[model samples]
Target: MISQSLTLTWRSLVPLKNSPGQLLAMLIQPVFMIVIFVYLFGGAAGGDRAEAVQYMLPGVLVQVALMATIGTGMNLATDIGNGVFDRFRTMPIARMAPLAGRILADLCTMTVTLAMAVLVGYLVGFRVTTSPLEALAGLGLVLLFTMALSWASAWIGVIAKSVTAMQGISTAVLLPLTFGSSAFIPATDLPGWLTAWMSVNPVSHLAAALRGFTVGGLDAADVWITLGWTAALLAVFVPLALRAYNRRVR
Candidate 1:
């Protein structure tokens, strides 16, 4: 049954073989955002900024992973809309298989997007102060963060009444979280009110942890905070998403 479920996931990823354009579109937004931020924010404003790339790169990468969740949710919604979920429900597979499989299927695309984004940053003169091992760990952290969010998105798709509604609702939830946090700058750099919020924001912590890795500082406190938040998100969202999946199936 587990094998069958995993096969379903592999089958799902196979369709992308013919949909290069879709993958490209999925990746372009993050790359574009990186470009705009680096040029607009990294200019004279950041001239005195210590490790400008270190600061900006982490936030940019987080945005890439966070944005990828939208695509995952929307894809799942499409599957549900096209009657694929109904068909999968009828198949002999573990109940969680469909959701797990779908999440696994997206790993490749998400990894590619991350790699491309990092590569673009590197090309434009962003060097990691961290060693290769720490850099690898940083990559793992982002992957973990992305997966947790992806699971939440899957649940969103199952509960959303329609694919379009899923898109709208998820976008609504995401935009503020992305913009309101310290993805683009230090919390202290923002207004007093925004700074207060950012100090406690999980996204800010992740960005801080990432920045630490880039500088080889490996801020243990920030990393612990980020992991704690990711774990909490998984603990809550996993069951919720699973419940929704079961409901959709039944």
Candidate 2:
């Protein structure tokens, strides 16, 4: 199973080789967006450039993490549409091989996005005040959350009618969850109703947890909340995605 999954992972990565433009864009987009947020709107958002980058970087990372998964469903849908799964079924690979491989491949891309975001954040005056270990833990939290959500995305990919439809549906769900969270602004700054919702938002907790890691000491409550959210996403989505994969293959 592991070898088969690895092989499929390599196969999944081949697209990156073929489409250099997409890979270049993937590396560039986060840097551009973070710079705009920090340099252009920094004063308006957080009163000063450095302060705004500090306040906004975590939220931006959370948003990027979520956005990174948006393409997972679309790619999975494309593979299914292209009859790739049919070919896979003929091989003696584990049932989950293709799905797991695709998820792992996406992780590679997410790693680049996260690393580049941090580098760019530093260039624009974002600093991590917490210990190095805590900063690492914060990045782990982002990866965990993204991996969990990507399973849900894989499920959507298998179930959606088309690749375009998959992208549309995933974007519709992610955009609101990201923008509505405490990522960009303080929850207190939002309206009461939205604030209440943001308090429960997984993105909000994840952002807060990350902010604590990068700009302040740990927040035990936020860490636990983010873990709970990650667990919930994985528990609910993993089985659903596997089931969807099974159905699609059949």
Candidate 3:
């Protein structure tokens, strides 16, 4: 199963070789977000551009990681819609290989996205005040959260009736999660009701945990909360995704 998944992972990535534009777009996305959010909204939100870079970059990393999962769903939906899974059905490969392959391929792209975000943040004056190990841990945490979310996205892709449906569903769900949380502004800046919601928002915890990891102040509570959320997401979505994959393929 592992070998089959790895082969399919390469198969999934092969398209990027023929179409470098897709990979370029993925890498450029985080750079654009960093520039727009940190530079444009920094003064208004964080008192200055540098401060904004410090505060927003971690949040942006969480946001970008979350947003990247949408592609997983879309790709899965597209494959199903285009009958790629049907081709897989006849092969002797493990049933889970296709789904696992898609996810592994997504992890590769998301790692690059995270790296690009950090590079852009560095250029914009965001520094990791912690040790190199902590900075790496920060990236690892975000990637872990992203992997959990991808399972949910994969379920959506498997169950969605069409690629357009998958896209719509993903955007509808993700937009609120990204914009409603502390991804752009502090929770204190929001109204009472919104701030209340932000308190429970998984993204808020993720942002806080990432800030702790990359910046000077590391919060143990935030890290625990983020891990809890990751576990919850994986518990709910992993089974759903696998079941949905089986149903879709069968």
Candidate 4:
């Protein structure tokens, strides 16, 4: 199963060689977000430009990580819509290989996006005040969360009627989660009702955990909360995605 998944992962990635534009768009997305948020909205959001960069970069990383998962669903939906999954169904491979392969490919994409975000963040004056290990830990946490979310995305992709519907559903669900949380502004700065929601918001915890890891203050609580959320997402979504994949292929 592992070997089959790896091979299919390469298959998913091979198209990038012929689609330079797609790869270019992926590379450009993080850079664009960092510039737009750190330069244009930094002053208004964080008061000091340097402070804004530091505060916003971690949140931006979380945001970008979550947003990157949307593509997983869209790509899967595209494959299904185009009868690619039908071909997989007829192949003498593990039933889960196709889904696992797509997800592994997405992880590769998410890693690149995170690396790009971190590089762009450094170029824009966002410094990681913590040790190198902690910075890497922060990135790892984001990836872990992203992987869990990709399962949910894969389920959505499997069940969705079309690629357009998958895109729409993903955007609708994720936009509120990303923007409504502490990904942009501080949660305490929000209104009472919104603050209440942000208090329990998983994205808020994930962002806070990343900030804690990269910045000076490392809170065990934030890390724990983020892990709890990650585990919960995986528990709910993995079975759902696998079942959906089975049904779709059948």
Candidate 5:
């Protein structure tokens, strides 16, 4: 199953090779976002663009990671719509192979986006105070968190009627979760009610943890919270996604 899934993961990435422009477009959004945020709103947030970059880079990465998971569902819906999944069913591969493959392939794409985000951030004065290894671990954490979220997306994609529907559903959920949390701004600045909600927001923990790793102070509490969320998401969504995949393929 592992080998089959790995092969299918490679197969899933073939589209990017054929349409390199798509990859470029995906990488461009982070650059634009970092520039706009740092130059326009940075002064208000952290007193200057450089300071803002230091504080905002982690949050920006959290937003980007969450946004990227939407593509997992959209891509799966497209494959199903095009009958590619139906063709896979005729093969003798393990039932989990296709679903696992899609998630793994999405992880690779997530890494690219994360790297681009960091590069753009650096250009805008985002510096990592932690060691390179620690920063890499932070990146791994983001990927793991994203992978857990993508399972839920995959389940939605498997059952969604169309790619548009998948995207719509994922966006509706993600927008609230990503933006409502402490991703772009300090939760303390929010209203009492919003602050209450943000306190428990999983994305907030993820963002805080990332910031801790990048800025030289590891928040052990936030790290534990984020890991708990990741485990919980995978625990709930992985089985559901596998079931959805089987039902859809059958």
Candidate 6:
């Protein structure tokens, strides 16, 4: 049952046929952020182009993965809209397979996004002075957050009344989550109230964690803060998504 369900995921990747453009769309923002930050505002950031690139890279990478997950909900709505998931229910399959497969497929997309982002970062002079193992750890941290959000957003997809609602809801949430965090500039640059907000923003912690890792080692505080948010988000959303799926099947 599990094996066949896993096969469902691989088969779903078939969408990449006419969907190659989807992945390219995901790359656009990361690359744009890299270029604009390095070329336009690098001087104002009080650092070399490389330093500015490295700082902004994590923020954009997180944005890439987080943005990339919007499709999870939209696709779920599409499946419902097109009657594809309904067809799957008539077949013998693992109860959780559809959602699981969707998440796996999205994870693969995230991997591709991550690779493209890092490549752009490197091209713009972001270099790792860390050990190979630490670099892997840094990459792993980003991937971890990516997958966690993917899983959480899948729930949003499942429960959304329509594809449009999912987009509106997710976008509304993402704007503050990105801009309210430390993505563009240090929290110190934020106003007093906003700086206070940044101190507690989960995305701020994530950006800090990724930034610290890029520089060579993990920040213990960043690790704990990110892990806490990941746990809380997963705990809240995964079951909600499962319950939504049950309703969907009914």
TM-score of 1: 0.93
- Candidate 4 — which pairs collide? none
lDDT of candidates 1 onward, in order: 0.80, 0.89, 0.90, 0.90, 0.88, 0.77
TM-score of each: 0.93, 0.96, 0.97, 0.97, 0.97, 0.92
Lowest lDDT block of 10, candidate 6: 42-51
lDDT of 1 at 232: 88
Off by over 4 Å in 3: none
By descending TM-score, how would the candidates be arranged?
Answer: 4, 3, 5, 2, 1, 6
What's the C-alpha lDDT at position 191 in model 3? 90
Worst 10 residues of 1 by lDDT: 43-52
The 10 consecutive residues of candidate 5 with the worst lDDT sum are 40-49
Q: Report the candidate with higher TM-score, 2 versus 6.
A: 2
Clashing pairs in 3: none
The parts of candidate 2 lying over 4 Å away from their true place are: none
For candidate 6, write residues 25-142 as lDDT tens digits.
7667678867776678766454677667767777777777777788777877778778888888888886578877887887887788788888988888888776767666766777
lDDT of 1 at 100: 83
Worst 10 residues of 4 by lDDT: 38-47
Instruction: List candidate 1 segments past 4 Å from native.
Output: 48-51
Q: Count the backbone clashes (under 3 Å) in each candidate.
A: 0, 0, 0, 0, 0, 1
Cα deviation of 194 in candidate 3 (Å)? Answer: 0.8
